[model samples]
Target chain A: MYVILVYDIGEKRVGKMLKHCRKYLNWIQNSVFEGEITEVKLKEMVGEAKRIMREDEDSLIIFKSRDERWLDKQVIGQERMSTDHFL
Target chain B: MYVILVYDIGEKRVGKMLKHCRKYLNWIQNSVFEGEITEVKLKEMVGEAKRIMREDEDSLIIFKSRDERWLDKQVIGQERMSTDHFL
Candidate 1:
């Protein structure tokens, strides 16, 4: 499944946030991260990422199908952002 | 980024498990499921999927990067299941 993690973060700290997520999530592919990803595991990743962030930092992790209907609608409604930013 | 959801389920009910995940997660394209997947949203999906299953059914949603080092090592140790099952 195509899991797109959209983290809204500061331009200065986005790099650090991505790196932390990559390490905690063990991400090595485009935007993909993996482990024994149960609900608990997922929560742990988010918590760890949150802990690593500054007090004002925030992030969003979006998971969806490549052909997700709602996402397609979102792309139509919102300005389409390049996937390369995270990739 | 490839997020693979490995659902451990009954042989009889695997099809339904996949379908439910597809609907709730909005999966399309090679095991990809997309939604505004927050920790809460992920929990909701898991709960919904669990509720839909029968007493004999079980499932595990394993999300990982396609190049997850741990998963690659797992593939070396464990049997590599075909991706087609979820795709």
Candidate 2:
């Protein structure tokens, strides 16, 4: 499935979320991450987020597109993929 | 319904998308916006995007959640709502 993850949280924890997400998906934009992930991995991501989240102050949204072929990913700004490899 | 819109485009046109998007939705984060919108308004927004989009070079995605009540909005960063009125 195609998963789009967007989050809003406090400062320090945001870093943790980013690190946690990078393990499972590609970081597409500030506080937003998206890519194809398996059901197993998706649950793992949710579990990790749940483990790290500060429920009262943090918010996380997962947009699940069962079929990506029908998913319209539109961009009106720089393509994060164009950037040089961080590694 | 709840809508999540994300985009990626070239430099010059990116501004246009941002301006166009702001007309119908609140700018939540860079290149991402979400909120409740009526079907009528949703079409209007989509029409506007389709009209302004440079089909070859730009991309726009809209994620629709049938029921906002069931939508899970999780954030691991700052809340855009608390940033004080921009106007």
Candidate 3:
């Protein structure tokens, strides 16, 4: 599936979360990552994310689609990071 | 259409952006919003966003789908905001 993951992590653990997410997806902007992965990989990534997050304060949300073609994306103003290489 | 909008705005202008987005979509997390809206409303929102953003430093991204059913959302850890009312 193709996914866009956005996270709001406590200041202390955010860097670790960023590093871990980078291993599985494209870092598109501040605290935002997206890319394609299998169901197994997605499950594995979520497990790791749970470890880095604080249940009381940190949160991660994933928006999933069966494929990229099912979604349309538009960017306005400056793009801090690009996921274009994946194309 | 259903759209998921995420933004990276300069600290000074972020509050305004947040307020503006809330008028059109459900706040799902920090800097993240999702909900259904007309093509015209989306365009209007984008236009207002451009006015508040500095083209060199801020960026707004919108991920659109034909309908909410076409996408799946998963939340991990604490959800900063609830978007259940719309559902």
Candidate 4:
């Protein structure tokens, strides 16, 4: 599946979350990552995120689509980080 | 169409962007929003974003889908905002 993951983690643990997410997805912008991954990989990534997050203060949200084609993306202004490698 | 909008604006202008986006979509997380919106409304929102953004530093991205059913959302940890009004 293709996924866009966004997180708001406590300042202290955010670095760790960023590092872990980078291992599996493209870092598109601040606290946001997106890419394609198999179900097992997605599960693994979610598990790692759970470990890095503070249940009371941090939040992680994933928007999933069966295929990237179903999602139309538009960008306005500057492109901070490119996910063109996936293209 | 259902759209998930995310923006990375300069700190000084981010508040304006946030306020503008809220008028059209549901705030799902920090700098993240998602909900159904008409094509006309989407275009209007994009135009407003361009005006508020700095050509060299800010970015606004929109991920659009034909329908919300085509997108699946998963939230982990604390959800700072609820988007149930759209449901």
Candidate 5:
């Protein structure tokens, strides 16, 4: 499962979070840092992120997906998928 | 499962999201809106919230809890709990 984090932080603090993520996770980058990640590791990363972002009072969106399909489902609800022409 | 939405929206947009949530959920308040919510209803609220908060690129932390203990666990990691005096 992957951790989906959504927050609006100042440009500078974002840099800080990125630095910490790299130090802990090594070199990895996805469009939004998406990939296979365990809940423990994700929680660790989130803990570090909260430290940096706490000053700014940023909002967060962090969740573990049951699978790829569930993640996709949340991205686009069932209603939208039901009406898709490709299906 | 409950949806945990963490997004740092502008003061004005937060007001808007709160208004929408109240209308849709029919009066509910828990520090950070903790409770059971369907995926469909949450998707709708997030969709509307996005519209109001779009102006500010806010981060979000939205997740569905597998259970109450899991939620509590995330709030405090396993390592922390292992040393708990209460336990």
Candidate 6:
């Protein structure tokens, strides 16, 4: 299965979050990640993200798509040029 | 039907995009918007969005779910606290 992970955080510790997410998935866009992951891995990572994020001040949304073909994506321009900006 | 609208852009004309999107959907988060729209309305709005955006420097993604019940969304924290930030 393919999963798209996007996160919203209250703190400015996006560096840590980005690093943590890179271990399991590709850094596709700002706070957005996607890759093939098993159901078991999805559950495990979701649990880990929940644990790592602030319950009241952070949110992690995982859009699980059974197939990537159903999603059409297009990338253009210098959208994410600054790594120093928010992740 | 329910539609999820997300966009990536190179220029800094987010204020116009935000205003345009707000006219048709609810601004849920930065560069993210969602609302219940009919199939006809979805198509119309998508065409408008495409025409309104820069073809080479902007990209728009629409996730259409016939039923919103299928999506599991959890929102927490002060993630989108700033309006001056990127849309």
Per lDDT, the best of the predicted structures is 3
Q: For each model, chain A TM-score?
A: 0.44, 0.87, 0.89, 0.89, 0.57, 0.79
Docking class of 4: high
Docking class of 5: incorrect
Return whichever of 1 and 6 wins on DockQ: 6
Ranking by TM-score: 3, 4, 6, 2, 5, 1
* Rank ordering of all candidates by lDDT, starting from the highest: 3, 4, 2, 6, 5, 1
lDDT of each: 0.44, 0.71, 0.87, 0.86, 0.45, 0.64
Better of 2 and 5 by lDDT: 2
lDDT of 4 by residue, B1-87 (tens): 999888888899988888899999989888889899999999899988889889688878889999999999999987756544431
Candidate 4: residue pairs that collide:
none
Q: Which tens-of-lDDT digit does each residue in B1-87 have in candidate 6?
A: 666667765466656767777777776666767678887887777676666778676766666666666555545443453243454
The local lDDT score (0 to 100) that residue B19 gets in candidate 3 is 85
Q: lDDT by residue for model 6 over A32-56, one digit each (tens)?
A: 6767888888777766676677767
Candidate 6 lDDT score relative to the true structure: 0.64
- Model 6 per-residue lDDT at A6: 69
Candidate 6 regions exceeding 4 Å error are A65-87, B76-87
Better model by TM-score, 2 or 6? 6
Native-to-model Cα distance after best TM-score fit, residue B58 in candidate 3, in Å? 0.5
- State in Å the error of residue B64, model 6: 2.1
In order of appearance, the predictions have TM-scores of 0.29, 0.59, 0.92, 0.92, 0.41, 0.67
Native-to-model Cα distance after best TM-score fit, residue A38 in candidate 2, in Å: 1.8
Summing lDDT over every window of 10 consecutive residues in candidate 6 chain A, give the lowest-scoring window: A76-85
TM-score-wise, the better of 3 and 5 is 3
